[model samples]
Target: MQSVERTFELLELMADSGGEVALSDLAEQSGLPLPTIHRIIRTLVNNGYARQQPSRRYALGPRLIRLGETASRALGSWARPYLAELTEITGESANMAVLDGEQIVYVAQAPSPHSMRMFTEVGRRVDAHATAVGKAVLATMPADEVAQLLARTPMSPKTENTITTIESMHEELERIRARGYSIDDGEQEVGVRCFAVAVPGAPAGAAISISGPEARMTRISTDEVIPLMQRLASSLSAELSASA
Candidate 1:
């Protein structure tokens, strides 16, 4: 059991180091002896869970892709009931998204009953800087890590309100942190507005959102919407933690 825990710890450390790490770096980061780290890494490499790069650093292997896709699908399935509840309560579209690599991917959604409503296809990927769900997840990350991620992806404008500069994005993130929620006011798309909150204690970066046309969305008070979203996010987080 201890060995199993150690192996998973190393894997998570490698993932946190942008998917690759040297043996020495792993040893330092994990506080495990060099020999133990080497042995565990060798086992992972043999089992196809990890690979040795040409540069001799270790990276997550292709086999994990299958596991990731399966888990993501299951996560979406488990989140549907909560999303439905949010949509029913808010009378708007509800969505759940996860941070995948440098992008945000919608995993599940529940549509509004109204004829005119917002819809984002499941599995659609978008830049993290442009959407409420994305910003909600980003607000949970360290400033330096957020900066690094933003630097890796071009912050192209999706609409006139899109935040195009890292400095301005940082300011927005700060506001989200202070308010405990994020807002996309015609940022991802003109005429759409959204409110999102991060799922507390989620294993990965995940968030839930409610969205609608700006005309209707603006009519919903933040005092009401933010608390509802936060409550639902917490309930969903608890469910996820238990299942995990």
Candidate 2:
């Protein structure tokens, strides 16, 4: 592997372990000699990116929290305007969710004007099969990955409306493609419906959705919602691509 890639691999190992890792363990995990791992870790500690613990284990240093927060703020800022536009256009709740493994993470959200609605909390992780945003992003992946994720985390029925089988999910994805958007149909929560579209070129784990109470969402059917969602997704794609 390239030196930068290898360095990141080591960092990820540390990060996954909550910043503390034994030198021997790091060497074993990274397939590098203990001496080499020690040298690299020394450089990282000196640079304030990592530190060693009392037990001789290394952990992410204080500076990493600053860097992580900065990156998250930047990404949230980039997504906020797009989410605002979706909520503005749909006059309902809009959310930006990114895939984290088999779950979808809500990074940004705007609630509807109505008093009663299904609101997802920011930073909350939920089952992908339960949300419109999840389905939208899932549709963008290759079929094999879709099958793999479903296998690793078997579909559990979240509601009477939830999709509980991989075959059903595959069919739903096909329909998402055919219709150019996704529909939640109270799958995640009863009496809540959502419309969604893929955020094109998102780093393999992102989507956008507009959701509201069933009574209101039914007014905007697939034909109406799909066009607006497609337009917004097109604009978001342009914005993200240009930024990339």
CA lDDT of each candidate? 0.92, 0.80
Top candidate (TM-score)? 1
Model 2, residue pairs in steric clash: 19-59, 19-60
Per-residue lDDT for 151-180 in model 1, tens only? 878999999999999999999999999999
Residue 94 in candidate 1, Cα distance off native in Å? 0.4
- Candidate 1 segments whose C-alpha is farther than 4 A from its true place: none
TM-score of 2: 0.74
- Taking the tens digit of each residue's C-alpha lDDT, what string does model 2 give over 1-244? 6766767888887754545789888888789877877878888899998888888888887887676556545555677787787677778888888776577878788777777766888878888887899999889988887887777676888889999888999999999888778889989888888888888886546788888888988897667767776777677778777887
